[model samples]
Target: MHTRYGSINREMLIKRSPGWRWIDWEELSHYRDLLYFLTIRGIRARYAQSVMGVSWAIIQPLATTLIFTVVFGNFAKLSSDGAPYLLFSFLAILPWTYFSSTITDASVSLVQNSLLITKVYFPRMFIPLASALGKWLDFSIGLLVLVVLLFYFKAAPGWELIFLPILLIILFIVSVALGLLFSAMSVQYRDVKHAMPFIIQLLMYLAPVVYSTHTIPLAWQKWYVLNPMVGVVEGFRAIFLHHPMPWNWITTGCGVSIVLFILSAAYFRRMERGFADMA
Candidate 1:
């Protein structure tokens, strides 16, 4: 009886230990090659049979920026902090596009990879991570357009450009956090994927993508930065347009993004165990 029990325990241990752990850095490291493979797969899958292919990246944001310039910049006469309306709108749209795509892709990653989730035993976060990374590749491609727009408008890059990476890291953290949270919930509810586009649209307006937050009444602006993207967009413009960088807004954005990221990641890890069953 003792020998039999020992064999069973060893089998259980082997089966369980090889599976994902809660925030296991070492295990994730072991599977880094899989992450690379999935990320490249995601990029290829995005443009697989499309004729336009990766050019779609620049076209989407460029088209939206042009529409915003005509509608918001021309018709509504929205302020762009004295910058050229087209360049102003494009800068905001750039980051917003990156953030929106990251969340959208990452949120649906697990459900979309249902077969892999059930058949494989790896850190499922890789699904979202790879999705986010693939989208990051798109964002990098899109930046070439932004550079062209900057030269077209004669907008000089500012010293604050150095801080752009830090800001992007914060935004990326929030994207992954929300992605993981929703991806996990989506496995169970199915409604999350349905609602995500609408939710992201609402968030885009709340952000300063189309118009400057300065257009808001002074009293309300303080409450507005609570949205996080308020600071993010402002910071981006400050870099590209060489506008003023308010320490207060940047600090608030960094802090809020960090806190939300941590809480969302914890929630995701808690919900992750059920993903295989529901997915």
Candidate 2:
């Protein structure tokens, strides 16, 4: 009887080991309230007492669309794959702005919250996640502008519109992946802070934001898709402009991006233990 009790106790311990030894999913769930609060805090802090408030969201992307329309649409005579210049540029800019801004903010979230890091014991992931989530507000506003532009141009989205949400989710994941990777690097190297803006600016031109992917040679298209954003930008145009979905490129880019996200997340968690001390 005593031997039976010992074996049963051993089984109980083994069953409980996961809860004690590994990632505590339940613990994270319990902190859902905390995540909600942090997300709200980030949103409020962003727009607090700003003159334009949420309207800044619409203005930023709208202004970029206008500039691109002049430079690329008029002077450069860039082909927009039969779509109106304003409509073409606005759709691409919407996702680009969201990705760029989220990446920039998330990469610095920990450093910017150094005080909170030093003082508190919440999950460090919350900082970047909250920053990324906050940008959705801007994305939402930009989306509204896109709809208005479509109406003014008398253009209706094609059947490919069904894929827009999926493409946006992929873009979001890509942005967060890159953000976490850089955020981890930034903790160790301050130069990344200074380099980020220039890097993003360069990436913008490299992406098909102001022009169509059709401009690139067919032979080189596969290689260009390796840029990841190549697929995203093209995919956005395909959906919004009634072009065929770049399925092969989108698949390649989304697959690579998802892997990158997983790897970057692992790296972040591994390094996260040291962040409180380092920050």
Q: Pick the candidate with the highest lDDT.
A: 1
lDDT of 2 by residue, 195-257 (tens): 999989998878889878888899988777776787888888788777889998888889888
Q: For all candidates, what are the clash counts?
A: 0, 0
What lDDT does model 1 reach? 0.83
Candidate RMSDs in order? 4.8, 5.6
Off by over 4 Å in 1: 1-22
RMSD of 2: 5.6
Clash pairs, model 1 backbone: none
Q: After the best TM-score superposition of candidate 2, give how far the Cα of residue 173 lies from its true spot, in angstroms.
A: 0.7
Model 1 is weakest, by summed lDDT over 10 consecutive residues, at 12-21
Off by over 4 Å in 2: 1-27
- Residue 221 alpha-carbon offset, candidate 2, angstroms: 1.8
- Which ten contiguous residues of candidate 2 have the minimum total lDDT? 14-23
- lDDT, each prediction: 0.83, 0.82
